[model samples]
Target chain A: MPIEQDYSKTENGTQPVESDNQDSNKTPTLPSFTANKSSQTVNTLWRTLITPNSPNVTPNSSYYELISFYVYHGLLVLLYFNIFIFGLITFSINRTKLWFFELAYNPSKSPSVISADISKLNKIPKRISVILNLKPEETENGGISGLISDSSEVCAWVVASGIKYLSIYEYGGELKNNIPELRRSVYKKLAVYYGTDNVPTFSIKVPHANAIYYGASDQDIDQQRYKNTSYKPILQIVLLSNVDGRATIVDLTKVMADLTTTNEISPKDITVKFIDDELKQLVGEEPDLLILFQPYLNLQSYPPWHIRLCEIYWEPDNDAVTYPVYLRALQKFSTCKVNVGK
Target chain B: MPDWMSTFPGYQQILENCTSLFASVVRTGPVPQHIGFIMDGNRRYARINQIEVKEGHNAGFESLARLLQVCYKCGVKSATIFAFSIENYKRNSFEVDWLMELAKMRFGQMIEKGDLCEKYGIKIRTLGDKSLLPRDVVECLEEAERTTANNSKAVLNVCFSYTSRHEITTTIVNILENVKKGLIEPGDITEDMITNNLYTGDQPPLDLLIRSSGVRRISDFLLWQCHQEHCDIEIIDTLWPEFGTMQMCLLLLKWSFNRTYGRKKYRGKKETKKEKEKST
Candidate 1:
């Protein structure tokens, strides 16, 4: 029952005092007259019970009123029961999903203890992207080689987990010269895990299911445009500065301005469709999951247009990237309800 | 009628007492000056309840009313809600029409003299491209804005037919036009100049952003503002209609805690750096 109309106004306000005894004392005590008055009172009571908000109607004054009370209260109880049941079902489902996730990816356990069985997990995201913040402090601990080894380990785990696409972005460093070495190491690690024949083959002639590197230069982007071969289970290593330089909204603004001038169209006529097409040609499809290997939730100059609807998972400790942590991020992404503002 | 009822005055009194107690507890924390909401999950709520989409939107409106009242009591000054978006037009015509009708009705209520606007002294402003909306709906929204023009207690910014990308693009176009007209030099186009051209330029930077429906994404709503301010984002699992006062209070408490202790370390460093620069 709605709370607004649950109670009668008379219940909150003062009720008028009844003068039944005084009226009876002043009138003659005739049995026939008293019988008729009693019948009239019963009729009026029945009328009030049948019609809501009737003038001179006092609720809960008779047996009919008691029945109505039970009806209303019973409906209210049932409504509450429905709400309680719905809440319980939702809670148990969420609890079960979380329990399953924790069972598979136990954070308390060491990285070796958590096995990488992609089939056993509840869900695996098709595309997984990780942003590694190679700040001075991070590289100072074990040098650039340590960062590269950590990224390679992450890639090996991603391949082992059967993710179709993996992307690794390194921020705060000039890594253009080291791309070949990093790619070779990642390929070697994958070969060790999946054997030589099972490892993804790399070829500069074509965009194959292999490790590819993109640098922070327009030439790299132009080179990518020519190699349009579709490859599954490909690993893309991108420098964060490269994506930022190429895929920033500022670039979109430039494109919009040029289009407005060249095409002789109003700027207001430009929509996301035009911008999206340009972005798709620049940056590939948005990743299903974005994992930030940072101590805090910072984008680290990530391109904004690409991640509008991307699910972001952050590792707060900036700890070594582990297979279990990667799996857990994928699981979290799968459970998320992408409402899309519908 | 009942023995316990005899001891207590009424349920309303008990409710008021409890509300005041909750308010006092919330008063201990720092309230945000501006908060943004991505109101999501209405259609899902309707699907779960097996009700019509229109009824789901109505329930969402009820929740919005309750949330606004709670925010007012909690001392929140300004709130921007993602009520409608440009992408929403892609939905089926029936749903789009229903939503427009709902907006019209709600705005009509706001335009009426003695509604929540009068009671809470809320200044309502529709922030978006109005040309795309129905004429009657736009009229109602304008009338509501005109009616509550002088309100100073609180501000409600309804992002109807709005998208952050479009807003940014529009602002950029405005800047380019100004430069072309020689009203402003191209070199003088600073961050502040672009910001002042935004629909929410006069409003305070967002302190917190809350998205309901378990989705962990910004959905192109206030992307630039949130990214610029580094606003704390909280994604709640509950649908928009089910996001009640208690949930809002919990989110506010979390925001207050983060503001007081979490981000202060980095903020302090930045402030000191600015101070040293000024001294030099």
Candidate 2:
């Protein structure tokens, strides 16, 4: 482990910031904030610096994935330098695309104005899933607070746009640990958009952690009329990370394998529907649209089963959680036609 | 009588040679050992071009052959094409039947030609439940596999009548069958066990997955293999029929570029500061 840390330190410059951010997120308090809009502007830089973005090559899911993950990545460092010009040209092309999108979608547009733009769209996704990445703390609106605010910002937009369910996936699962702060942040953001008196109720679900949090406090007399019809919240939010994706499936397979040995379940019992229902219970239903707020189209190990038939939207060379990308994704979703296997 | 490029006798050979030179240059960088293709948008291409659906499929098959040759030239070890899906069975009966006929015809052609197989030393494998296929189609696929079985170089995974869920499910069933026979224990079922048990398990773990016509969805193809960080899913705007060898080569080149300088930018993020402190 010590050697691994030393190796990481020498290998990646972002190791220091990554470890520092981890310590801050483990605590459950909100620090004072001062916004710096200039640096926080969503840019293509700094995305590649994130570490442990790959699955842990631990002994858990041991040999095959572990061996290949390293083997394939290890080959990248061979550095033939033959395709250097080709690489440079392709690299510049990607950044140019990001610049084009920046011009198209102005980041300075306020949330309500973007909401109106979203409202003008002919259709919207009922269930929307987003993949969020955490930036280093040195930048404004980066790290833990940035993740919470980003989640809250999306929640507020979805609520305004009348979307029912939203799943926010951060690779590290840091938001899962800070549910209360996330709830507080989300509620505050909702109040900003919907006004405090008319704030709609919502719930935050962390399926992996087996916890559900409500936006409205129980002691609040303003929420007393909603007791009998508690079946549905206006907004249903689920937080997910890499753990809930493949690792969950690996654990389920182990369970099924164990059950087969005990004669509790037969080999034939592991059917498509059986695994589907089981995974649906473990991770929520497949979203109608999966939006990745990354520079490129990488799943970053999203729950694989749920991605089937789900339309994915991501801007090229863009990696910030902003209203323009979200609004554009909704527009894209509205234009898409999902004819299952037709 | 001839395609426009082929109208010029020397044009075809020169183009291929130049492409091979370009491919060799790109191949000098990191190359993904295994590549997967969803091959979407054939029907759309047919609709747009006002061609018969079968013709669009034929065009797609030609494109795939050319692309596969290019991939071999670029030094990829194996390639998986989602030729047919279990859910694709839901399409109209006529189309399904024609698709099956297409598979049979294509597999038979590959075997009969014997040139591509001999040239590339390609081993052909059909992944999915063979029980679902018609007996005649099964026999053709089997014959193709058998003839190419001894080829020790590369593999072409034809995912016919396959879905990732079905593959994982059946793999579990096979594992349990072993367990029932006392050859394996339930406790031994790690992820690698599940991985190795799948039909394409012996092939390299998918490095790059490509889908055409700009639909950014996995569509239940290689869901297990592609979820990890090692795999990159590229959704191109070109329809399958219109997808060309040059464009496909560009995609492969993009993958190599990203793996080399693009993504590796993160690997040395703080190395300068760390090295300075160590030197002091």
DockQ of 1: 0.08
Model number with the top TM-score: 2
Output the lDDT of residue A300, model 2.
80
lDDT of 1 by residue, A266-334 (tens): 656656666666655555456778887654455544555566777888644334465545776777876
List candidate 1 segments past 4 Å from native.
Answer: A1-116, A119-127, A133-147, A161-188, A195-233, A241-247, A251-269, A281-284, A293-301, A314-320, A332-342, B1-29, B190-192, B263-280
Model 1, B1-280: lDDT tens per residue?
Answer: 2337537668647755655445544544466778999988888899999999899999999989878877777678899999999889988899999999999899888657778888779999999989999888888889889888999999999999998877877777776665445576544555566567788888877878888987777888887677542577777889999998768866776566555445422223434555888999
iRMSD for every model: 11.7, 7.7
Best by DockQ: 2
True contacts kept of each: 0.16, 0.53
Indicate the residue-level lDDT of B71 in model 1: 79
DockQ of candidates 1 onward, in order?
0.08, 0.27
Fraction of real interface contacts that model 1 preserves: 0.16
